[model samples]
Target: MHGGTVRPRRGWGGVPKINVYLPDDLAEGVRAAGLPVSAICQRALEASVRRVAAIRRTALSAHEDPTAGLNQFTDRARTAIRTAAGRSRAAGGQLGTADLLHGVLDEGANLGVRVLRALGLDPAALAAALPQRPQDPVGAASFTATASAALELAVTEALALGHDFVGCEHLVLGLLAEPDGSAGALLRDRGADLRPARQAVVAALVGLTRAAPDPLHPVLARLDRLERHTGLAP
Candidate 1:
């Protein structure tokens, strides 16, 4: 990382070596911090593999409806997804993250709405900020790559949350987590950063509110950390 050689790490048998390039400053920083680049890369790669596996199970083909096979997501989330599909169809395009955001806002009763409000996001305003599309129609619509990726992240989020049921909140997190999506940017612009939004989600689901911090928060956090450490986390 400095004047010394950066060598390929030795691992389990038959594993190939590959170099991970880093900026001079960042490499120096990592050296100074004593961070293990190989371990970091391995963990990240493993997580990515898990995420890809999850997506493949739910992925729709070219001719498949974007809104179809969404029974894995909650009923309310499915309804909102219909709104997204309709919006995409009316716009004469593939479903996108923007449309997904609308799906979160289509139903006022969605837990996603309350979760956003809890994070100080105005759901109504967020929906209004997106391009308006006709809401009446429900049809099979393909999804943009961005939308597909976001939905994939939604599944990942549900797994991370240890949730058997994928909810609207997970979709909200997915929209906010998908780096290439404008919907994620919109949420971040409204201060819905991934970490806090995730915390807000946990709190909301467990009956916590903005009024005060839940006493169970620390316990939950510890348990979550333990879950990851035990390799039980997704």
Candidate 2:
């Protein structure tokens, strides 16, 4: 690991080369001029990393995540958030996309779990795929930048679905929205894409849609569901 980032052996001394493409003419000219392209690229990437790190720090430095303003999370969603935070703490790392996935699976009774099962994605396997150690360490914070972004996306998903409260299924959708994030990548690699997962959610909740008084009908119904709540799914 070079500077906390895993690198493949490519350049001298186990350094990885980030390929920089250039037009033939430009490449020829640069080669003729013997320009230090590697150094230039390193400098540019470092500057970009600094800027991104600053933005992330700004987002997470607040004691409470801005998503708290849209606090219409159902019981399972709230529990999942708390569970994710707890796992992050126990792992000695900041809350991240993987932790959020873990939270959903940990709860074991949410629509999130059902969606995974319906997709033929094993929740246990997904949880096992989570890195035992933090992938990249960002300093102390309630949630990583990716995690915070996913939470915002979760609210968006809930709103788009015409639901009054956020559900664990929405959290799954949020994580999927951030495909560059760790857990998102894991899910995508396993063929659990967004549309099909939502299809699964809709299928499970179709029975509860009629004559419901509030938007929380699906979420509450899922939580209070006792049939196959432990090992079985929705």
Candidate 3:
């Protein structure tokens, strides 16, 4: 199935050229399927660039505080916030919780994305439900108050779950806690209730705890407590 060698396109405007490496079986399958491997690789690369840019944006936005502990946000969560910020900036709209939800889906691989997929919710569809705005006359993007509140709640969720790092799963909990946020409303309308989402989060964390034991000890303990409290423990 594999015949021609995959070539790299020349970089333009200071963009570096990248060589793609594919396994024999996968490369053969791509050739057999007549897929546009170069285009697919380009798109994936662009998405990765966007995600990295968003992470940088998120890190820069946070103020350095000596008194307060430094926030430990997973790459996935940072990317989600960055994606939300990018969407708001593009539309000249303030970043909101809904944008954050869209960002989580946009990131593709994360706890929130997995939970939503399990519920048969399409990330693209969730994104479509967000309000679209025309480009602003003077471009400026800021976080809405509600969005800020949700972020704080995300931190709180992480603490409650006994996690040292904030992640996309905590963001989902934040969305669910935000009473008036569009993200929560949209998810609820689509049958993603808070309880089920929490359950999924716990279950996933439990699996992770078993798969990788040391880093997740506190999280596993918290989950055990929660499960017992809810009478869901075996």
Candidate 4:
């Protein structure tokens, strides 16, 4: 029962015991340093378990629905729009491009957020730039003409990209394509140009399509470099 002899719990069933192998020199150094090997290993395992669970949650959220039609939008994209509509309704204003912008950021893991981060813009700051909506309007909130046009353009962007599902990236491009939209204006004011953002989205799609077996691999290594170049990432 000495302090150094304490070991982590073994499995309840027939599971095998886990072991760690270290280089002789490293093992000797650790022993000489009087490190608590079991405690260190336990902490490392706990951190790894948390990381894996987060990845699983993200993957589940991004999973494509099998029942969706060929031309139907991805669940994430649809969720973003629904979130936007809800925001508009709460504000007593019609759904507009600005609401859509907020929705994409709210969705969290979509390509639209990646594009904004790639371009060195804080999504939260961009969201804060949207104009305040009036309260207690007379009628139900609906999509504005510009917002409707943006949705149609999103479909067109998806088709052009040869993707079966419309996504947040397409929605972002659609916002930029719209001639008169507050969301697009806000993006431009934050230095998010259409051409570069479009290029980044295309590159990101390519990387995702060609990603290797490891889920944590840097699919956007080039984009990461670009972000670093722009002082977005360290």
Runs off by more than 4 Å, candidate 4 = 1-71, 132-139, 212-234
Cα lDDT tens digits, model 4, 1-234, are 113323444665854346676656556767888999867767655644443333223211113321133235667787787667666766767788998888898898998888888888898888778766544333346678788777767766655444545789888988888879999888887888877887778676756756652662443454454444334444
Order of quality (TM-score): 1, 3, 2, 4
User: Mind giving the per-residue lDDT tens digits that candidate 2 earns over 1-234?
Assistant: 112234445888867765665656556766788989878667655644443343244333324442333346778877887667656765566788988898898899988898888888999999889877453433444688798788767766665454556789989999999867899999999998897876676665654554463884655465434222222235
Stretches of candidate 3 exceeding 4 Å from the true structure: 1-70, 132-138, 214-218
After superposition, the stretches of candidate 1 with alpha carbons farther than 4 Å from their true spots are 1-67, 135-140, 208-234
Q: Each model's TM-score?
A: 0.63, 0.58, 0.63, 0.57
lDDT of each: 0.73, 0.69, 0.71, 0.67
Name the better of 2 and 4 by lDDT: 2
- For candidate 2, the per-residue lDDT at 216 reads 48
lDDT tens digits by residue: candidate 1, 1-234: 334335756657957666776657657777888998878767765765665554445433334554455656788888777767777776666788998898889867877888899899888799888877775454445677888888888877876665656789999989988999888888888788888787777767655433333765664565465445434447
TM-score of 4: 0.57
| Candidate 2 ranges with C-alpha deviation above 4 Å | 1-70, 133-140, 208-234
Colliding pairs, model 1:
none
